[model samples]
Target: MTNASTGQMTPATSGVLLVLAHPALERSRANRALAKAAKGLSGVTFKDLYEIYPDFVIDIESEQAALSAHDVVALQFPLYWYSTPALMKEWLDLVWLHGFAYGEGGEALKGKKLFVACTTGAGAKAYHAHGYNRFSMDEFLRPLEQTAHLCGMVWEAPFVVHGAAVKDDAALKAEAERYRARVASLLPAKTEA
Candidate 1:
């Protein structure tokens, strides 16, 4: 708990947990690479939510336990309907219990960190004021940010790769590299006073 009380993350930080929730990893490109880069790091836990609960039945207890074990928690998936995939929503609703994630006595996530990495079929230019998506990505993500705040977690700037469907391998690789680094950078202090 010493690390949890300090706001500085050491190389010995507990771990980074990446939760993957894409509907189909076999058909994915960008998400796949991003998840791959995060795999096998000593202090990293890569959990594929969809793969575990394909029918959308999230394990609240297990997930809560996972959350309790990590310093940095990443929610990685494709952008759907301007937010997260349905299973993710279901997962959130079930796993982020009131007394655990947020409530009068809920402090399980206090001082923890949240980071999001997503890809969209509509390129970067589309998620703007007049773009096809009609709103900035950040704007679409307010609910999530507020949720993190409510749970006493710190929200990091999202790492997004728009136009995911058609980006070339090199382009996708570059984005993946950025995603890896960004995820790596999210390892915050081990403890927060």
Candidate 2:
């Protein structure tokens, strides 16, 4: 795929694991559009956490294996209650183990890239100190950044679709395209041997 911003053809080497965490995907237009945007990209692996682990039973080994195979890990979700959905939290707790994600021997995720692509119900103006939400989106995402730090991963800027609930169809489509481009950009260039 060609990157929209740089106009460069992204090689297949740019492996991205997009972990989606929307609890009720059927009910969300924004997330569904975003997910559709990511579908069938060359080196992008899409995993819906809620669908894969409906009972909250995460396969630690599988999750770890998936992480190990990707250069970029993107968490896609809706900002629920100012944080990730409960299943995402649970997945992190179970998969990011002491010896795998952090601690003495946890070097598996070192140098990997971590990012979040999320939707927010509130508008951009509502996410400031003076706004009703009372905090910037960046502020609300600090914990995820810190998690990347602790795991020795590179924290990339998050892709946020603000005011999702009220965006018109055109706006939603544009946002989804932007998201697809962002995900495509995360892929590293292919080096010739």
User: What ranges in model 2 sit over 4 Å off?
Assistant: 1-14
The digit string of per-residue lDDT tens for model 1 on 48-163 reads 98889988877789888889888778899899888999988898899888999999778888888888888888978888999988899999999899999999998988888888
**Where does model 1 exceed 4 Å of error?**
1-13, 188-193
Clashes of each: 13, 0
lDDT of each: 0.84, 0.91
Scored by TM-score, the top model is 2
At residue 86, give the lDDT of candidate 2.
97
Worst 10 residues of 2 by lDDT: 5-14
Model 2 has how many clashing residue pairs?
A: 0
lDDT of 2 by residue, 111-181 (tens): 99998999998889999999999999989999999999999999999999998989999999999999999
Question: Which residue pairs clash in candidate 2?
Answer: none
